[model samples]
Target: MKVHERLDQELSKQGKTQAALAEAVGVSSATVSQWRSGTKTPSATNLVKVAGFLGVQPSWLSYGELGGKTKTVDPKQRDAYRRECVWYHRPAPQDAGRELGNAAGFAFHGGLSTFGRETSQNILDEAQPGQPTVEARYTLIEISGSRLNSFLEAIKFDDLKPHLEAAADSRQKVAAVIRRGLSALADDGRLILLRVEDYGAKGLVGPEYDDGNYMAVVRNILDSFKGDNAGGSYGLGKSVMWACSQFGMVLINSTLSVAQDGKREGRYIGRLELPWHRLTAAEAGSPEAYAGPAWFGEKDEARGDVTRSYWGNEALALDTYLARDEDQPGTSFLIVGAYDPDERFQTIEDMHDELVRALAANFWPAMVERAGDDPGMMTALVRSERNGVTIKSDLVDPHSYTPAKARMLRMHRDDLTVDSLEQPGDVVRRRITLEVPKRLSDGAHGSQQHEAVLLVTEADEDDTDANRVAFLRGSHMVIREELVPGLRMGSRTFHAVVLAGLAAGGEPADKAADRFLRAAEPPEHDDWMVTPDVSSSYARGYGTALKNFRIEVRKAIREIVGRPTRDLSDGPDALKELLRINPPTVDTTKRPRVKSAVGKPDAEGRWSLDVRVSLPAREAPWRFSPVLRFGTDSGAAIPVVWEKLVPETRCTVTGDVVVAEAGAREVRFHGTSRADTHPVMASLATALVDVRVYKEASK
Candidate 1:
């Protein structure tokens, strides 16, 4: 925070005009205007007078120091200050309906890895125009005892405790999760906070509650104010942070690229999502019902008690555990009471690994540097701490995780791709034509052809998730990865990349393709398809064009790597005449075959298993139900029910069927069998698992 920022915020907060402040401080109104504009600083004597008039300490007004301390606010004034300093929105009594939970938060499957992907995309999308690279950091910190107590006091947790407790008693599904979060805090006396910070990017800049990045992220829902070329447009990505939090609360601190209120740093606020609930007059100051969402900031009484972001001081920021290390333009999101709903990341170390893996898998292109001078679009780092002790610190190296794909990206960036591959490490480039249809509103007659670049190379033996074509557009974020279809049996394993739009780096058609593919993306932005936006915007039969475009992409891949069919007629004539050569029989076993399985009994006597299954390539999604059993050497296997099933890669669990994404050759999942369902103790039995393809009963 700066002196001008402090002066401006205090003037608005106190409802005092600049002229009034100047009169009180014995200065001309023009002098005060200069002070507010940051053109001149107040003299020491004038500073004290100005502070006294505003009822704030001179040190705070001058340099954002609180009571002459650097990191601690006055303990006695903590609650009182928060009560008066921060605004908390309660539901209006005359509202027509109640919202149980945030629908946007539920849009994503709550997991740490998913959170990483969404946040990283947001960071990359906000990269500064001329900066070489944007830097993102993920920090997991555990606090307890005094440290935790101070944080709770700073945020005025008491103001929120009654609402959380009331919502928990309501017994809604989201409330049940909140109940467990409260229980864990009481039982362990600790809280885990996940802070995502980015540098070299645009921060939350604009009016506190109007049309700008600030309002788009902090004050509104389903309002993505990003450009057409940005990675995400659904405006739901930020909800992932709230979903990851066990407490449904997230705090924000941003340093704006453009100044707001004559200042550019320490813009801080917090938001809490809870179900609508009522409180008795005894529990709160008055009997009240809330409308499910609340904000933490300076209360604007003039605006129906709505809260707006506050210009935070160093002491306030440090106490809330949101102090940024640098003065760079970016934002930091602190997920209060953060926890992985999937339970895959039980320890900080697990979280560290997941963040790195997720980033490398989804944004390797943005992390790949070109040859000489130019840097990649972004860099990432992950750090973990327990009670202020560093447990792990990793600067993610994208090449280490996705070597083949990263190499291709580097080659593409440097324009080093060859026409065909002749040796190992060679990248082959070709053009796949995409027929982009004219928009329905454009009044155009025909479609335009856009050339999308396709890069392919032989995959390294150790490369994981190889032989898949990654789709990217203007943002260079992977939209989806799928195996190329129509490849001959025994085709060499390879890695492929389809770069369209600006990522293709040439031709005016790039912009047209970018707009087309962007409109085709759903809210998750995971894949491009025939979406409502696409249907309403494009001409008739646009879906067919999209289908053909995908087909052409696959056809190009096959041309690059598919082996030629063998000629049976070349064999001995007598043998060939007698032999019945089947024309490439298709594998009808849609069921995934278990390639490997491992398990162990946990302390609760439940069998925990990690299984990998391989499937035949197909355009349609494969659906299967995993069956768990206890096996014996010479006896019938006993069936067991799974207590939990978590998809690990390229699959999703819906109802009872695990739907593997189309073109997935293999998938991995983790399961824990119900101990109660076991015929005997899990430790005394061998776990057997099978995946059965789901079949619809014939009428």
Candidate 2:
């Protein structure tokens, strides 16, 4: 393919004037004319940059080759790299036009845009006044419900086989409709977490990230596919998946996503970056800041007369930090690929259970809003016709659990922070109720011990008045300082309370068997079992199991602040918690009750607490609206809310979860309790012995 001929075709396809294309690539019209006339070739380096801007591959532009190379590397590093790329980068190239990074835009059907700078440039002239600046990013975050099912569906070779048989080509050609849907997922993430409209002006809050982590995240999510798994039937989503990534090649888009809910989160598009010699954080005047004028905390800060979306610029009057790294840049898709049951799940049934938990994690409120009052609005990735969808969590928590008792979980504390990253973020605490069946053992579908898994880390994070009032009329919490895992993985001090039902040995014994038991010593009898079979009797038992389980789950969730799982196979705690702390019911008029109980340590390596303390709540309402608020507290109108609480629904977190911890040293936990308590009796029918060290006493 002649480079000049290809260039003209792309210019015509992009509906852009050559002059306009020259301006975007920072090349003179004369240079473009030369390349077009075949008088001269673009330098390899310039070609690469130009290709990126046009959403084409340098390999295609330079060597006229196809099938961008699939990365192969050390598995662990590959997995980590994939997480960063899939969650941070834009979608991968899926078509020939995309592979070429055609600037004229691929022949993608079904959508048209009047807003994007690229689109406008294609329709208008260069640097025209009144033209809006192109966005630095347009990202998407996607999560799947049943990995087995999604993966299975993604690999419908039989269906694809027919298409392949008809054509000599075996390379996949995704239907345009499918591509649009996949694009929608990534688009939703960007729209929710990065894109914003402030006072009639569209804006962005996320970084125009150009890092390894981001690129890998985008690639893993938008590239890889799965073959066979428990519930997966056909691999249709794969077509759109590849198309989504390639779209960015031409549009400067980057996406970040994870295959499994809690499996990974990071940049997907940026992983396409080639490594540089060495880069680090350097002092400003001693040198390394952006060269030009800027603002400290002003909304829509301009960058050298260009106002896209940048927080820091102008380089002076502030402290600076630099980050430098060493390594020849490469990419991987380990975690992103490994998550899809790559021949090691042990059993299909076990894979199903993992899918349930994955779906139930419901952690992305910015992407999809879960409303219990309005079940229709409670969108989750884990949806089924009969039950509903599960959601992935995003809090980046390191908590774990086990079945022990039946109890009510409630709100513990909701703290707010302002000026966190030069700005502030609010902190909230949730206390939830979890149910534990008396018998403790595992099973195919439902295990008695899994009932009490609070899964609070995947619960909600709410927005309220205290945070807004403290910051400015429209403030929301931004996760400025992420709670990183301690050297001892789960060692952070997570303040929580397990409100067990009377059945789990609470003050008031509340039992579920007495109210819904099918027989005596239920765990031993097949009739009383929740997973003993597919018989009518099993279905009957499942009904009773769901009924009792939902009550405790709902109560526990009311305290969680963000979106939750509406239909969880185990406890449904995630969904219930999301419903509880949605802020609509927030009576912020009251002060958050942060109670401290006085305690004294004893010689037996233990401590006892008995002190008078008041956890107070004083209701005082202020502006709770996001953005566009006149400020109930002040007459001056400002940007109402900080973006985090209601962040543009994109996957912002970009990392992997370490292994779940064991023993007292571990901090947050999720699991069923050892004993079940009779709510009516307020005592466990059985005795307990396992103890977790919530904390140690000070000397």
Best by TM-score: 1
TM per prediction: 0.69, 0.20
- Lowest lDDT 10-mer window, candidate 2? 469-478
Cα deviation in Å at residue 34, candidate 1?
41
lDDT of 1 by residue, 1-699 (tens): 777899999999999998777545544577688889987766433565578689886645754542122454665545544556563756745854788888998898778878998999899888878876787888888889998898887888877888889888786888988999899889999999999999899999889757999989987989889987788888999999988888889999899999998989988888998888877878766537777788888778788667877775656677776888768899989999998877788677888788878888888887776443134777777777877776766556555577567766765664545555433444678988888888776654346788999999766333478778999998878999997766675465689999988788656678788888998888778888999888998887778878888898898888777653222334432343456476345434224565444445655677766566677777777788888887543466688998878776799876556888878988877777888888988757666667777654111
In order, the Cα lDDT scores of the candidates are 0.76, 0.24
Error of 2 at 210 (Å): 36
> Which runs in model 1 stand beyond 4 Å of their true positions?
1-84, 441-446, 563-699
How do the residues 12-115 of candidate 2 rate in per-residue lDDT, one tens digit apiece?
Answer: 78787876655444344666788878776664334544575566754345433311222233455433322221111122223312232221122222121111
Candidate 1 accuracy as lDDT: 0.76
